[model samples]
Target: MNVHTAARIVPLHENDPRSQDPVLEELVDFVGYRPNALLTMARKPGVVPALLKLLGVTLRGDGLLTEPLRFLVAAEAARGARCRYTTTHLVHAAHHLGIGWDKLAALPSYLDDPRYTGQERKALAIATAGGTLPVREPAQAIGQARQVFTEEEVVEIVSCVAMVGWFNRWNGLMGSVLEPVPSEALAHVPWLKNLEV
Candidate 1:
């Protein structure tokens, strides 16, 4: 077995009871495999539904934040929390949303890349701040975000990051394993190398 498999606190298999859950089944269908982070959360089955509901609101609900920006916030939050697992998943998700591969590959240098629009950079900065603990949201960052977005959009961005922040803590504490699907998809991403630690 791989060393990363040691993080499995509960069995999560095709035959596992939770794997049969409609929601879990939907997720499996979407990703082409069961994500190990969700499996860790599956240890307490009740948590899955609640988290999914939260995901529905933050990820799929009507909001001023665009889908791509929300994915960026999620990825940035995962990056801030240092969870390669979640970051990999978010990057895969970004690809599915039709974001350019070059931009995804250049993620490590997002702050310097001319490809990112002014709003994207500001949103990313907010995601970075929201991801960190001690909640270090700088005045300047928030000000920049406010300039680029409305108060409602700013709230949406922060809310999106906060959702990912919870998953970061949950998965990190569980030592959640990185499943093959996401691991394979993100294998070539240069920025992901920095998160191996």
Candidate 2:
């Protein structure tokens, strides 16, 4: 695994609590909670600014899924690809949303795990199979997802996975560092230490 520390860069726009609209504040908090090493790297070259702008538009417009669900989809994609940096970030994102480490770890096993609800199981199966299989296989997974999610929601979920997969590939290829999870969060989620590729 790569051990280089990621250098933090300033956000293009100030994250002042007073200056932010309610929705923007929520988005900022969500981003702040996750250690996105890839975004940090991208910011150094001005890529993050453009990406954030696009994300802002998407979030404000057609992103039909909730923030936590989008994060979950990305987490599944990152885990399946074994991209440590992306996985670590997504894990932290899940933690921020009150998801337990055991639940996060069991994501890969959700299809067969009795603990998952039918909808949760279906989403996980779709995410897992979509990550591991080609686009064609994801058609079946998408069909399953449609049973639980609206067409727009399913598209957002699939888009989240695809975006995470792209970031995971880049992080792996660039040998990005895995930032440690926050100490407070780590204390509550010991299973994170045992996470496997």
Candidate 3:
């Protein structure tokens, strides 16, 4: 799982511009804007499609995890594991989803944070703890999540956490370097300066 550093990395070309779809365009934009190890891995034959499919399943599914929460889980997993590159990428993505860096910074103390709702606290707690703790007592926490999300949504939360864990391990092991998010976007997230990761 070595991180590819080819100067001219190749990725899938967009389909005909006349047939340009909004979803496809957005995906392309995301990849173009954030060229990371994941995107580099995706450029390999037979891997990009599978990665896209997984993303589709997560985004199009009827899961309880909101877009913000999904991004947060990825950010937290990267942060908790000290995966600097992944953490910064996820934090930037979370910011794009309108999740403030302050809120993300306070995630570790979510249980006592007044800014987070009961359901949000539960989801954050589950993601943060589940990453490190083997035995997760999610019954009560899941119950709280149920108040705001469907069973499918609960599954999404768990899946997002798992996805983050997987990527964090991969990125950390690979020693990926942190790429600065565009300065304009970074400026909007003042709290990012305070993030230790």
Number of the top lDDT candidate: 1
lDDT (tens digit, per residue) of candidate 3 on 1-197: 23334323433334323223454446657634533455455445555456556766664334456687777766665555555556667777777777876776676677787867877776676566556545266676677777777887778877776766656665655554445553333465454444332
- Cα lDDT of model 1 by residue, 1-197, tens digit: 12355673754665777655677676666668877777767777688878877886886546777787788778877887777777888878777666776887776567999988888998888888777887775677789999979988888888888899777777667777777777754555767756742
TM-scores for all candidates?
0.89, 0.69, 0.69
Per-model C-alpha lDDT, please?
0.75, 0.59, 0.59
Residues forming the 10-long window of minimal summed lDDT in candidate 1 = 1-10
Rank by TM-score, highest first. Answer: 1, 2, 3
The reply for model 3, stretches above 4 Å from the true place, is 1-25, 59-64, 133-144, 182-197
lDDT of 3 at 101: 64
- lDDT for residue 148 in candidate 2, whole number 0-100: 84
Each prediction's total of clashing residue pairs, residues at least 3 apart in sequence or on different chains, is: 0, 0, 2
Alpha carbon deviation, residue 136, candidate 1 (Å): 2.3
Off by over 4 Å in 1: 1-3
Output the number of the TM-score-best candidate.
1
Give candidates' CA RMSD values in order.
2.5, 5.3, 5.6
